[model samples]
Target: MKTIIGNDGARPVNSTKILSPVPPASTLTIDHVSIKIVCQYGKLQMAKISRSSDTAHVTYLTPEGLKEARAELEFLKNEKRAQVADRIQKARELGDVTENAEYDAALDEQTLIENRIIYLEDVLRSAKVISHPSGSDFVVIGSTVKVEMDGEVDEFTIVGKMEANPGKKRISNESPVGQALLGAKFGDVVEVSTPIVRYKVKVLQIK
Candidate 1:
């Protein structure tokens, strides 16, 4: 999921490869074998873009997104944990461990709950809390932007992938349209292209 942008052009590097030479098996007892890896690349070059002072300011997530995330974490900590513990205890009481469907289901539930708790914890830690700033007319990460397309006006808020709900007009900053609108000012026309279509829209307001 690494992204590299440069003046030359962007190209995705897949898994890099390394070759290892085999040693004689007779030289040592082959109880087990392991190898360490190292990588070196020669003189990498890149052109950097100058940052514009007026480039769009982004606020990562809205208060609502933060609240929802908190609620989810609470559910995972309280309700989900309790439910899984109860399932495990009930399964244990059923006896015959090897043939127990309930025990297997309980274990599966435990695995899922633990994984989700880890994910939620990470999300809460990394999430940027967003608030609507006073008197700011420019679009920022969490500011809801109004855009005009052929006389039709639509509003959407820019958000990170975790908080974006496109159906609700909350777009991920990584998305094409979102990227195009990143630094746009009112009355500025920005063109966005996707694999399926192209759109020409004007920035109207940042609320």
Candidate 2:
């Protein structure tokens, strides 16, 4: 198997120098990666990348994404509220609230529902939505790359966390294949290693 050495930008760069694969095998280090969230049209998107800092950055959704999140949260909250109200009314008709099993159960349900609503709201507030950059060239997001390996051809799209799925070959930018192909040009050879197998991949097309 062939090994592709990483370049650290010095002239005739240290070809002999190799970085020991970190344990836990993260595909890419999100050093100084910035995250943002936004919503557009009706779809929500999340974006992330390694920035020029010592930490990782990630971004997600647009205004549209936030709207969708809010809608779902509202639905859940309202449904729970109605259920609790009905339970309380029924318990009141049974006479004593202090001894009513239905009243206690209804209160417990309300408490759980409220907790879930708060949890969802917190997650939405912290989510970073990806904003599609105009003229985003070089496989930033939503770009499909076609590759060839040992005469076998395959295609993959590098996408956000929500869209990443291996079953459809829609890989995350943080995956082995995706990381190996980032910034690569057509006809260039790349090496990718996973727990099961290693790949000698060639770029046939980038779109």
Candidate 3:
């Protein structure tokens, strides 16, 4: 909304759209400047975060998990997309789109497919293929931990949220139990607290 004047005392036509005054493109470095296109949503152009972000926001995945995510994304794009498009075309032949139930359902399915494709793309982009590391000193993202609670021994792999399936002996690193177990070693007693219940777990093993 403000005018950006260059050294020549005239607004640079190409950069006038910039909301804030930026020096000439030659003066701005990759680290100093974040180019944003003036679009519908103002998407960042070629944005790159630090490595810490890559690790912190990273989705830890086994080789198998990574393969599955890619497969699902490809299937949705290559197979489901065409199917939805075909359905929509046929539904459009039925009548007006506003009153057509088949058209609406097909459109909904297309939206879901597209959304899932986007999700999978993000996931794969940020994915870190981590095999379960071998360590007995402390628990980490790829560690399988065994804990004793109330005379019962439960073993579960501590994994990122994307690959967690508690019923299959896999738990999310964000979970209370998983968070508490991280960096805990054998014979260390850790307390796990939830809104509904509180309990303690003694570390039995880590692998």
Candidate 4:
């Protein structure tokens, strides 16, 4: 058994299993601690934590994001589950499942659906809805920011990892640029570091 402590030193979390192996004395940030109930075992289990990034332990979502997640979960549990079950039933009626390709595929699809459902459930359970930043003093999650890099100005909305879509100009708060922009105020230049390149972006505006 290993005990996980919060970053704030609030309390110790006891876990019977360590999802991602780390040194016994390794310190984890608050973003790495995840507590979720396992439907299979009917017990709470600490989820795997990645060494590089936050892995959905404390999912941050905007109100719209939360609603979207809920709608998807409902569809998966209700419509998608029933559709897969029907496919399985039809496939089972065809012949022996041991050699039936349709049956095998249906079963595989069912497993994927179940896995997605579990993930969504865990995310929703641990979700923390982020509101629009109350002030423009500093960049925070849910803040729309305008920045200048390489003498070119660009705008981005800081969102959770789940809602991140670079093509859509929505960036994840955990992303290199996003992380660098966080806590930066207008007129502040912040350096974004990545393995490939490092550049500085000046915060021109925050909304």
Candidate 5:
């Protein structure tokens, strides 16, 4: 028996097996069987048998983003890890660890650093670097787009989710505006819809 859990409720099936060729971002377990499901940008795709421990997913990154992640991972694994270890050792020398606030704080910081190191390692392992767009004929992952909406002109670069910073005019390709602008050409108008509002923007340039 296989069961699917969703917003509506749980639905069960008999004499059926679920399988997904590619692993997704999330998993669901039913009847001791693990199924992979992809949930991104408010969309969901379910099906694929795998162990719950298998949590690898493709991380999209630009060339610079990939370099930054690599640098961070290197620093964490080499310098930061040793620094935390030294702190823990120094704290341990300061009497009973059970009652030592410095020891506890160092341990906490060590945990955080280790967790980040693991995350960055995983990201690096599963990264897919976005290639530079050719000619900017149409919007792509690395395109810097100029747009006009509500009589105001704005510019932003479309990057992977990991490098997205709205404050810096860098938006994720998965975002509503980026999705709408993708495949649009210069002087083309596109509709951007979000839960909060729906509006139109005209593509003024693509770089």
Candidate 6:
């Protein structure tokens, strides 16, 4: 398993003292960006870090990614919305809305679902669908890149921040590795620095 020992940005000049994992709600800076982190019992939240230029309304997506998002939105709007509404209606029939536990729970679920629906709607509304820029060899979102780091050969598909899953080798464009490789070509050496560990990443190929 990979590990990261955060640096407090207070290390002596060139000092390499490694910091162990911290408690919940800890804030730190990695790559000059302010990152708010919360870790509970060693389980880290998979945060979707945004690009410096990102706007709340705009989201970049590939065709397949867009399709997936649209499908999820439809499900949430049609199925999940109906499910929660039914639960609320049934709960309301039981007794007072103020004292009913089932009613409260149903309302809470409804709020969460509606919030997500709004977010997805905004994303779809402002989405900028893009393909691999023609004749461009530089790394960009939707590009499959092969990299060598710490003697491990791996390939990663760089996608937008919304679709990045490190476990699946689909890295977010705003992530350390993805950020480093953006606009880089094959045979380029990139540095990936995180609060945990830093490594030299060499680009081998792009597709």
Task: Give candidate 1 misplaced runs (Cα > 4 Å).
Answer: 1-59, 95-99
Candidate 1 lDDT tens digits, 28-78: 212232222222121111111222333344436577887887898899898
Clashing pairs in 1: 58-141, 59-141
TM-score, per-candidate, Cα-based: 0.61, 0.45, 0.71, 0.72, 0.69, 0.69
lDDT of 6 by residue, 95-183 (tens): 85545789778766876787677667767877888686655688887888989999999998888877788999888888889899999
lDDT for model 5: 0.80
Model 6, clash count?
Answer: 1
Locate the minimum summed-lDDT window of 10 residues in model 2.
Answer: 38-47
Runs in model 2 deviating more than 4 A are: 1-57, 60-71, 77-137
Name the better of 1 and 4 by lDDT.
Answer: 4
Q: How much RMSD separates candidate 1 from the native structure? A: 18.1
Ordering by lDDT: 5, 4, 6, 3, 1, 2
How many Å off is the CA of 144 in candidate 4?
A: 0.5
lDDT of candidate 3 vs native? 0.75
lDDT of each: 0.68, 0.62, 0.75, 0.79, 0.80, 0.76
lDDT score, candidate 5, position 84 = 83
Give the lDDT of residue 3 in candidate 6.
44
Q: Tell me the TM-score of model 4.
A: 0.72
* Total backbone clashes of candidate 1, pairs 3 or more residues apart or in separate chains: 2
lDDT of 5 at 28: 71
Query: Which stretches of candidate 6 lie above 4 Å from their native place?
Result: 1-57, 132-135
The CA lDDT at 100 in model 5 is 72
Each candidate: RMSD: 18.1, 22.8, 11.2, 15.1, 15.1, 16.6
What are the per-residue Cα lDDT tens digits for candidate 3 across 1-207?
345567878553554343344332222224433232221112221222222223345677889899999999989999999999999899989986545788778766876777677668778888988887875588888898888999998889998889899899999989999988888888999999899999999998889
